[model samples]
Target: VRVLRPLIDEAGYIEAIEDPNAIVITDTLANVDRIVAIATTFDGEAEMDAEVIRFTYAEAGTVATAISEVLGAAGTGARLSVDASSNVLLVRGTQRDISQIRSLARAMDTSPRVAQSETVSTSIYRLQFGEASIVADLVRNTLTGSTDLTNPVAASVGEDPANPDTKIFAVGPEAAPISPVSVQASIETNSVIVRGTQRQLSEVSQLIKALDVRRPQVMIEAAIVEVSGDIAERLGVQLGIGENSQTGGIAATSFGNGGGALQNILVALGQSNAAALSTGLSVGLASDNFGALIQALNTSTSANLLSTPSVTTMDNQSATIVVGQNVPFRTGRVTTDGGNVTEVIKREDVGITMVVKPRITAGGVVQLEIEQEVSSLTNQAVTGAADLVTNRRVINTTVLAENGGTVVLGGLITDDRLQSNQKVPLLGDVPVVGHLFKSRSDSRNKRTLFVFLRPTIMLTRADLEKAAETRYRRAQSAETAVQPRSILKQEKVRKLPLEIDGLY
Candidate 1:
């Protein structure tokens, strides 16, 4: 009785009678029932049956607690416990109470089901920047939808025995269940028709807006420069030709006796001064000394600007430039039974080419994947071969650079030495005294090629306008440079008429 007092007190019941042999507890119907169940279990007088039921989907602990509360409210003396590891519920009570609990558990333990009466609506969303078919596919992948109705359903039909024309239909539980959401794309109209609930439509609208925004643009500027001997050394060491320089302009310099050749080439191309060369040189030069330094180098070494191409493309899109021709080469020859031979020729590109794909990242950094190649047809051919040989230099790599910054893509260097002697054939073979009869000359040629690339990201109209202005300025400078040459030619023509008249 004393031990039962503590249990009754904990159950919020007052024990009205406490004796050595009997104890009486009283409370609300639910609380009194719970206290009596506990005392009966302690006294070994309650008939209890234990059953373990495993749930397939519903959580065991949550279900057990819910069932326990319901049984307590109904004044049923049942004990429920959960085995979380096995996801099973343990029920301990009288046979009738356990039976009721099992029934309730079976009704509650099921996979979550969707509402069959949800209100569905259809909406047509027109895309501004993205293709309708593409956006539709993206939406389908993002949301769960029903299978196509065109697919066969799991059902069968049988003819009635009594009446041959009568038919009996047997449908499976899953037959012809329609989903609450559906999406279709109309390519001709450039819109998507979506049938779904309000929540689903809202989500689809947000996703389409995020994916259909305008794509940014990128301007890629490339420089291909070829230098030889002392010019290559000076460009590499002093000008930092292969380093990253954030400047975006062109500069020209010549070395030794190459000034005249450089000037002639520039004139022929109708360009002059800085506008005629590569922007890579402007990376390391100061404005105050730019002219003086170019003048000094103009008298020493020679360099050539092979090509300077500027291209603009959408971000993450590829741009290609080819500055050469396609030449045919023999691939194979087939002899026919009629005593005729046929040659299989394939055309291959021979010249300079560049392919670049730029991706703009956070903080205005540009990641570039570049493939550049310089190939040329060679005069050297195999003795019995039908195809001519070729020399190819290729660079394929990826690098990171800041927006409006320049980076060197790669370089190719080659060296060749030649020696020649002229004398009487027999005299050249004689030693010592034969030296006067023979003259020997030796020469070396070294050349280096550097490729520079710059990427400029344009996120707004102002950026694009700025880029266009820069290019316009360069064009104007080129036109100004060619003006003087044209004037000189005009003056020469004018004087020719005067000189001819005076001679007459």
Candidate 2:
């Protein structure tokens, strides 16, 4: 609700019907009045400054109409989000109507979410990962273009980044006198002629291949709910949100694992509920106080991270809940060779750490320590990658742990709706590799080396490239937002239409 603070401060609210007997207590609520007065002054100053603003009014009639329009517009907007961090009140429209978005803020009696100099960074988790990228077209023309590369004899080759270029550089065959790449440098005059380097030729071939028509295509997608900067940054130093802005700045100074840590995140989480967008889902990690995105940006490997709920819903059905898996610490991975092949959902379970301090590696891997409520499902050795995390198909595995999940990665995949206190095995969905990890209710029970015993997640470059090549077959399932569209394979070439002298 937009309120002309000056008018609002002077007028207060005309309470249902104006009372003739009541003293003209127009200037009431001292704190509110001060805020309104300052804001009112700023509003007037803005008009003189000619700042473009949608017209608004604080009167009842105007308020009603404006709300109708805003809600109506929001109905058509791609996504609408409201975030409150510290003093910043962020209202996002969509790609369609940023310029013309009008909010009924002025008509609102409550404190306006937005104020002047409201410094709010986008909810790109700017601190977690520190780079940003946007696909830009060439200066005046599209960059993806045609290229002509020649092989020893005349060859009008089709564009292929892996093939050798004919015009600028000559590419020797895989089986040539250049077999031993280090020996032939003494042959050419004006230009240096070094041979036997298939690797070098291969790289050059790849660039020449990229030169032809295909800009980095961006895929638009729905934005996910993310934690705010203030919270993500805190997840770094303290466990369970040690020092944060829940109790304003005071809570942070008294940082510890007890109530202090949870207090920061819970408060910030309650207040934040942040939202933003990108062409494709991206992770922007910014250094402390980095103004905006800098270089050193690479595509973030998409993790199944979710935070907020979608707003599109009606009465009668159900409420939407959003949750994000947080990984405040560094991360490592151990994969079961999930090549392009889809891993079957053999079985499912949620591993709940019945105890606190379930021992997460410093590299951000959580091992839920659950009480031995039930014996092992299978007789496999309850250790190593061979072991499995027990799973029970349920939500919010509840075991009264210190903190269910991290603010950076996400909370435990536990359910709050579980019957309390009765012994519950850590829920495990997978038939294998569950259980053996149990912890106290609070996470501060024990401290393990943060970076120790981190496992590497391996996928051969060839395997990954092959996976990327075949992605188009199941394009619908690819995490295209973070991954690239190039993952979609190009049309297969049947034969190398090379005409003898000039390979076409």
Candidate 3:
């Protein structure tokens, strides 16, 4: 590394030292606002006039009055006052003669420990460290007995003056330099400063660096999870449901969890019940109730159990449900690995998983396969020993239906008439009149293994909400005579008039 020489060479040293109005701030200022005022005068023709300035110091009050009398004698129209509460010195003077006032202040500063004035007889050195006052005190004590240094003034820089961590000292030749190599410190930084012969500064530098060096501290910050600020307002439980006019259908799709995309899907299902639509069939009832139910299911009804705006159903006599399991298939292939011939066999699972993929057409037709799995338990007698047996049934079928329509998988299978007979214990045994005391009840049950499905296309959240609202209203209106149109119209105007629905 190359060492750079100071810009103040021997040739320029004399002129630099002779320049006036050169304010060198080495330690904390008794008055900090003066520097600010000086900088404020840079605009326009502004100059520091006989500006009234306030100063606070720990010395006797006479010092302030004395400064006032001196400024008055200098004919600068400067006035000094003492604030009673704070004991601060207030000085007012013409900006042009501010430097004169500073010089007078230096002379008036009677502290024997503080340096009174800058002179060619003295060289300034500043030492700075992080610890409060300790480093400056150490340096002062280290050279306290030496005759070369005088008026070691240590004070904290910046806003905190009482800290006394940083200091400046005037050290010069009480006689002459002991060595030829020159060394000087700078005023531009808050770090250590050393001024003397090169060898002296080098020694001082090593000591200062050693004192200032400290172990680096390591800090670890925990991770932060950022959530939307409006989450509570927009996704609160009240707005999550249909109660609020905004954020309808539980707002489940608005957020995500650690599980990724499908995390809130279950919540959406509970709120909207849109996962799988359900509809039932009644074979032979002497009433138009089934028709009304189906009609209600086809339209927007408050009772969602019947509503089927996107659904249609059909009855059938017989249907099939297919079951499939994937089986691994293997194939052997010859390949070259590192210039060596090798045969490798790869096995892949390739079988149907019983999932029916519907083929949708532009004409609003959906072709799909329906599968049903049924299991039954029965008791059997094998070689005079009773045993439990299990049987499984699988039915598969492919059918075509319009979009939003249902297809029954199986035709109606009617069971034989089942009879329940009751009679008096003894009277039923009388052969002749057993019929009089006995009562018989007969019931026949018919079942059509079917699937009622209506697959409607939902493009957006609003569409889904509309479908969910229709189902919700239908479910609520099951026992009432309210019209779906009224609900829709009122909901469009306001918040669905939940009071009128009477379903909070």
Candidate 4:
């Protein structure tokens, strides 16, 4: 029992975390002129009992998907090994091919060495349930009001009697207490966690997918300046994106292939594919614009916030950060009460509450109403309320330049518009469509009914069972089973926008 404590501890996780899943695909097919070639490969056998998985987490979306044309184009063997719960193809099939997946990683005017690997995954979790039949069972239990999600220790189960998921294992050595993903009360008033429900997580995943598809398409309207030799170095991404985000790719290319050459290459971006390009790009602490973006976020977004903005300017690169929140009223652009300048601040209506209603049951209705302290609420007549209006959502800005080049601006956002509900597609290349997802309900205080909103992903009980099975087998087979990293739920200003572009 003592030997298996660690593995057993993970058994408590019932669902996947509601977070953006970023992938950095390596470009192995880019030529000197920066034209990338995308190839495709095939699998070992035909699609038979393919799973109908959601790749994310929650309920009903965890099974493997069926083999179809929509999935065939992404890769070869990956199309066949479709476990919907995990959304990625871990298949063993034909040789490596790179035909249908390349994209614009750099400017077309010069040969950019920037490249990405073929990424084939969406976020999903591998869990071990003590005796729950399937993920669908838990979903039904949560939906039907039979399970008390507030008490993770309670047996909130579904109606189905005989459904099981991927990760299941017979009783084994006693393990450590496993902790599941959860959304607890935070210190921030406007901040609401996208958590608990399967649907919420799925929606957040789909929103990321949408942003992934749109960022590259957005045309960069910055004034294009003419630079002579070795200019790509001058076009430094200023956004404080971390080394793991969009700019990360540029830095890696700068180091991997050669630095100065990338600067000389020309980069042309269109609004249509800006989201897609952002997926592969990694803008990090190296840039300046990122710092500015952080300073712009005024709406009280998180509790662990650095109230006093951090401003640091070193050498040619500079970062200025100023963070404040205009709560109980809609925040507007910063304007000073001065007679020397034109209208700098905008006006706004004031209120102090966020109402959330959950559409969970097939036909049932769930209503949740929450309001801040009355002292926090103020009418339009209140001070500073008239000076707040929404013009732009650019918060947390950073400006960057490297090796003597023109500077640029980059920022991060607190209230994200891209995250929504849809079961993310698995590893199949076919035209991937998201599944139906929703956030979980907060039924802890039986005396009061409130819909606790958070990012959610769906998974079937079968998927959990399978994940348990995977973990159990690995534990038994290898000298030490490699446990998946745990996802923590917290929010802080993004120091490096590039880091947001995650690398697996």
RMSD of each: 17.8, 40.7, 32.4, 43.6
Which of the two, 3 or 4, has more TM-score?
3
Q: Model 3, stretches more than 4 Å misplaced? A: 1-356, 361-364, 373-395, 433-442, 447-450, 459-466, 472-504
Please give, for residues 48-71, the per-residue lDDT of candidate 4 as tens digits.
Answer: 223222322222222223332434
The regions of model 2 sitting more than 4 angstroms off are 1-247, 250-311, 315-389, 392-504
Q: Judged by lDDT against the true structure, how good is candidate 4?
A: 0.26
Provide the lowest-lDDT 10-residue window in model 2: 288-297
The residue-level lDDT of candidate 1 at 42 comes to 80
TM-score-better candidate, 1 vs 3:
1
Q: Tens digits of per-residue lDDT for model 3 on 1-504?
A: 011113223332211123653333322242324443443444324433443333333343666666666556657655556666664555555554666665565565553442223212223344443342455455554544343343224221122267555343334543232322122334354444444444455554565566664322111000101112222232233212332223233422121111211212222213243222222111112222223324432342221221121222222212222223332322444557667655454432221112244555557455655554433343333464323333333456766654333233323232335778999999997887988988989976433222234344343455455555655565546535554554343433333444434445
lDDT (0-100) at residue 18 of candidate 1?
43
Kindly give the stretch of ten consecutive residues in candidate 1 with the minimal lDDT sum. 249-258
Clashing residue pair totals per candidate (backbone < 3 A): 8, 76, 32, 153
Query: Residue 323 of candidate 1: its Cα lDDT?
Result: 88
TM-score, structure 3 vs. true: 0.24
TM-score for each prediction? 0.54, 0.16, 0.24, 0.14
- Which has the better TM-score: candidate 2, or candidate 4? 2
Model 4 poorest 10 in a row by lDDT: 214-223
* Of candidates 2 and 1, the better by TM-score: 1
What are the lDDT scores of the predictions, listed in order?
Answer: 0.66, 0.28, 0.38, 0.26
**Over 4 Å off, model 1:** 1-117, 144-180, 239-301, 380-386, 416-443, 483-504
